[model samples]
Target: MARPRAPNRRATSCRCSWTICIEPDQGTRVKQRPGGMPPHPSQVLARRGLVTSLTWLALVAAPTVAQAQFGDPGGEGTAATDTGQIGAAALSTPRYMGADHNRLRALPYLSYRWANGWFVDGINGVGYGGSPTPGLQMGVHVGVSPDREESDDPALRGMGNVNRGAELGGFAHQRLGSWLGGKLSLRSHLRYGSGEDRQGGQAELGLGWGTRLGERSLMNLGLAANWANQGYMQTYFGVTRAQSTSSGYTEHKTDGGLRDLRLSLVVIQLFSPTTVGLLMVSQTYWQGDAADSPLVQEKRNTMAVAALMYRF
Candidate 1:
């Protein structure tokens, strides 16, 4: 004969054996448990509620996240644990795409990811992404397209502003293998929006190599080329007869093709398990119709950024 098992109290009871509460000055405190038993169901629920409330509070008070103009630095890896980060960045870049001068600005950064392949990021936008296989990730997102202001450069005295608008896009990243002790990957992106008629489309393909520098430091190098459709080329690089007369420039017609090439280097340092710092430098070269436009005061552009982030 076998001995009978004890009745399960947890399945029958909703009463908590212990209680936990947060104090403003002392943080979380737990009441004594009578028998050193596991936390009751109500206690577990209360803990979850407290965590949710704190996370929401942090998001509301934190600064906005940084937007990466080059490419997302960590998009090629495997699925990540649920986490969130907030920070700020100092950025220096051309006022406009073809401007010869640079402008400095301060930007905020925030991002959050879930364990089930969902993320809301300043760089990648709000989207669901996952690795169907090891080393490959694909996803789609909706984001805002950048706008150009005529007042940003003296050369654009007559050119009107290109208003910002929404864009729909998709991205794919694939880790190829190792090269020179670094991880090599390829990435591609395509999006449509933002033009005089809001039909401009663009695509980019790039290669990236990343390596660890030390116990808490990493570095990445990237090179990419961009292609544009007729709508995009014409809106940014073409001039009409009426506008040519007003701006004292020749009326130029543009056809879609290769637009520009970019090269970038980024370094990241982990200050602690919960804190990080980043530095990046990049250069861009305009070609084809984009370079031929009279609006292009300079065909080469440089940009730099420094940022600090806190993870939770």
Candidate 2:
């Protein structure tokens, strides 16, 4: 698979903006604006309202609690914190890239640190890695690639479903000192998916800063870029002549490049010594040919998740 460089564009100059929102429940707040501007008008009305409403509803309907992530945005690996910690989280996200619908997911979070400087986490899937020094960590992980149903979106009327596959990858994290004496981290992930033509892997890199709001609360802000390979680009965004005819979209031949930039926020509140509440929100700005595809109805999208966790 070809690895193309991201085009020189104004979009590359944009940076992530972070805001700290504190509540009595020890919640964290995060909002992202790509290019530091409002979304395109066409997108504002199409999926913005739905995203906002769904997120708001989840926050209100969910129990007042928070959960922890395995390799959190703060650059701290969950296994390094508490070895035997175990918990679960329910996430709400869109079914597909440009879909208007959302789905609910429940998954467990686990971290086990062995005596041999090895660890495994359940949140992002089984992995072996941990923070070896004060600010550096590395690990390898293998996990299932969640499948996508073409029927989820009307625009994908004829596109075949993406089969569930596997991905194995490695990650590295480096701490960028602290923010106001709080911890900050930079992390990156490289993963290869199992597909004949989509054999190339994906790469992600991000910067994050985390702070303790109080004795029982923690919050993190993160910004990252996602790059796709030719196989991946074509798999999801490419439109063949037959597909174009069936899906009513023009043939779009996509090359590997920068797919999108993402900003994320994570907040965790410990309700009790063993119970926690978490809220995470992320915003993405699609770029290059990925955004130019006819299947892409909204170039900018929002994803929110609220979960309650109990550590045993």
Candidate 3:
């Protein structure tokens, strides 16, 4: 009886005395801080990050704008102070020709950017084909790039005796777009070498793409279509006396199913003015006619050079 009486008293107290704060009444308003002030640390950090990001964006954009105006020849406006709206070159060709495949060589080149979108290059190779023929070669190359500055990479000239015999001609290059290019050149090796005995030549045309591999190299690939030229084809796939006549030390000859291919790799190492190292390779495949003479079934060539560059 006593326990039941206490319970009854506690229940009555719970129903009357329970007190938990509920949400404010509907439409009730909240109070202001009395005075606006700076936000918390998180808010401040977010604002600072936004400001920092904007600053970095501006810094990145500034160089692009500058390059557009004064530096990139492939770009527009011709803001170069040297050109003064006339649009001139920054400097002459930094590289010259020397003998890599033969005993002596003479490679002459002339390149110009016309007012029109097209660019022009003239090339000539003079020498006795391995013999000292005093031969002549002349050819021309033309193409359009976004601008001339885009073609400034020196590694594009792979290893080859561009002019073989007494021929007259030049090499040609054209930029089809930002990522594609093409070239053609023709020559006649009428006579080359100390004997001055042989006579022939080939016409050449090539298409290629400029692309990046990984983050370390710039690459170029020329297609089989370019070698369709008879002259160019022969210059690459043809067998020379050097190949036909065995030195006894090494015998080499060529076979059938002629082919010529070139690939180049360039690496840019950033230092003071930035350093560039290049590797260029040329390969030729010949089929048939390989008898007694060590004909070249395959010919592979490689060149490596490192150069320091600065642009003003």
- Which number leads on lDDT? 1
Model 3 stretches with alpha carbons more than 4 Å out: 1-166, 178-198, 212-217, 224-259, 263-276, 287-293, 297-312
Strongest candidate by TM-score: 1
lDDT of candidate 1 at residue 117, scale 0 to 100: 56
lDDT of 1 by residue, 80-170 (tens): 2456767877877777777788888776767776656566766446766655665566677776676777787788778877887787777
| lDDT per residue as tens, model 3, 1-312 | 522321111222222211111011110011111233322211111110111111111111221110010001211111112111111112111121111231212222232332222332222122111101111112232121111111222321221233323333233223243422211211111111211222222223444443444222334443321122333323333335553342222423333222333333323222221122222222222223311222232233233323332222
Task: Specify the poorest-scoring 10-residue window by lDDT in model 1.
Answer: 57-66
TM-score of candidate 1 against the unseen true structure: 0.75
What TM-score do all the candidates reach, one by one? 0.75, 0.70, 0.31
Q: Please give the ranking of all candidate structures by lDDT, highest first, separated by commas.
A: 1, 2, 3
State candidate 3's TM-score.
0.31
Candidate 1 error regions (>4 Å): 1-81, 122-124
**Quick one: how many clashes does candidate 1 have?**
5
